[model samples]
Target: MSALRVALADDQALVRAGLRALLERLGIEIALEADDGAALLAQLADTPVDVVLSDIRMPGVDGIHALQALRARGDATPVLLLTTFDDSELLLRAAEAGAQGFLLKDAAPEDLFDAVTRVAAGETLLQPVSTDPVRARFHFRDDRAPVDSFNPREVAILRLLAGGYSNREIARSLFLAEGTVKNYVSVILDKLGTRDRTRAVLKAITLRVI
Candidate 1:
């Protein structure tokens, strides 16, 4: 297989250098590097990559804004936001902004590599950081529609979702058809009153259902 080409963006030069070394050691190719989100986007306009590894906070455009812009332009490229802080609000914002994964800058190299690979393969990754902070800071609105109870099988699927498994992966693990897994995911999202898998996982965590 060809090496995974990645675009890396961070404000700190040292951090970017360290990450580049680690990724290169793992045989991953760095297609482009940028000091901030704006540069990252500008470079991406000319360079295509398999994945994007970026810091969530930066001087201009930041990771969240960069990701929003990418999605707005119909770019579905998987993005993994890295951060030094474990701020719950930022995590939620990243998820809402269409980030494929969120990881701390201090994450192990293997963990970082795994996150990139998984996101590149179309999996939503949110397991590196604990969800307790999210649950604590999540404001539950009383006016929101009540969530439906999930069956045992659905709960099992929720667990897999929390682990960042894609529908096809979950289907294979549960010995179900891919289409069936998609249906279960739809049901889970409905039960959680969420519009996306990441939001569903966050809600599930907030509800302590997974």
Candidate 2:
């Protein structure tokens, strides 16, 4: 198969350089690089790439804005957001804007490469471990719909999932059938308005569900 071409956008030169080196070492082609979101969009208009790796924060036209612009223009390119920390609110916004995945900037090279490949291949990702910090910071609010909306069982399952528990493990811990855990997970995702577990976990943190 031909090497996958990727576009990168980050205000930090060094971050972009580091990502470029890592991607190249993995035999991925760097189709375009931009210092900010608008430039990234402009480059996308002129070049075709398999995936876009963008930093969530930027000086002008951040990753969220860029993603909205792309979606507004009917562009279907997959996007993987990078960040220095697991910002629950920011990542939740990215998901609403159609981001395919979120990864910490300091993530291992293998993690980065795998994320790029998976997103390029049209799969969504949100690491259980990566979302742990936000999960840990979850402060339940009575007024939040998420906190008030999810049942006790859903809440328990979410906590376990954040701890990197598999469905089987969560089932075992909660003393429920695996099928029951799966149903609860699906309900949690629906309530959080996310399609995948990663986004659901991030949204839950943003909504203070845990």
Candidate 3:
């Protein structure tokens, strides 16, 4: 495989320098570095970067806004948020803005490397704290909820999951087998355009699906 070229965006020059060294040791190339979102976007347009590692908070622009800008410009290069906090609201916003993954600022060197690799390969990787509760909140709703994409069965299943019901509880409530509930949950994940249960719900919520 070709070496993954990455752009790192953060206001901290020391952090960028350290990250550059770490990634270089693993044979990754630093295509560019930026102090804020706007510079990051300019670099992305000017350079060839397979992945973007961005800080959630910066001086001129923020990570979520940068993510939105990339998507609006139709760039599908994977974007990962590097953050120090794990707020659910921020998680929801990141997912909605099209971030492929989120890594804690204090993550181990190996963890950062793995996140970069996975997201560049079109995978979503999130820290456990930011990934788990998403399962309890994503769903089908609004005008689109009644469509075939959701339907009554899928809606029922989502409501149960969002309310903290287990598969068995959902099955009992819906008069379906436990396996059937599991299957519906799988379908929910696929139709919602997300990487996992949390992301799925966040997508559903963003789309007003649930």
Q: Please, what are the lDDT tens digits per residue for candidate 2 over residues 31-131? A: 99999999999989999999999999999899999999999999999999997554777876676678887888878989888888878877666552344
Candidate 3 lDDT tens digits, 1-210: 889999999999999999999989988899999999999998899797899999888877888898899999999888988876656667667876777877888888887888788778766654433434454445444536434578878877765554435677678988999998889989888777555655554555445555
Candidates ranked by lDDT, best first?
A: 1, 2, 3
Answer with 1 or 2, whichever has the higher TM-score.
1
In model 3, what lDDT does residue 35 have?
Answer: 93
After superposition, the stretches of candidate 1 with alpha carbons farther than 4 Å from their true spots are 128-133, 136-148, 171-180
Candidate 2's TM-score: 0.67
Better of 1 and 2 by lDDT: 1
Ten consecutive residues with minimal summed lDDT in candidate 2? 134-143
Question: Each model's TM-score?
Answer: 0.85, 0.67, 0.68
* Clash pairs (backbone) in predicted model 2: none
Q: What's the residue-level lDDT of 55 in candidate 3? A: 88
- Top-scoring candidate (lDDT): 1
Pairs with steric clashes in candidate 3: 138-201, 140-209, 140-210, 141-209, 141-210
Which whole-number lDDT from 0 to 100 does residue 128 have in model 2?
28
Candidate 3 RMSD to the correct structure: 8.1
Off-target runs (Cα >4 Å) in candidate 2 are 128-210
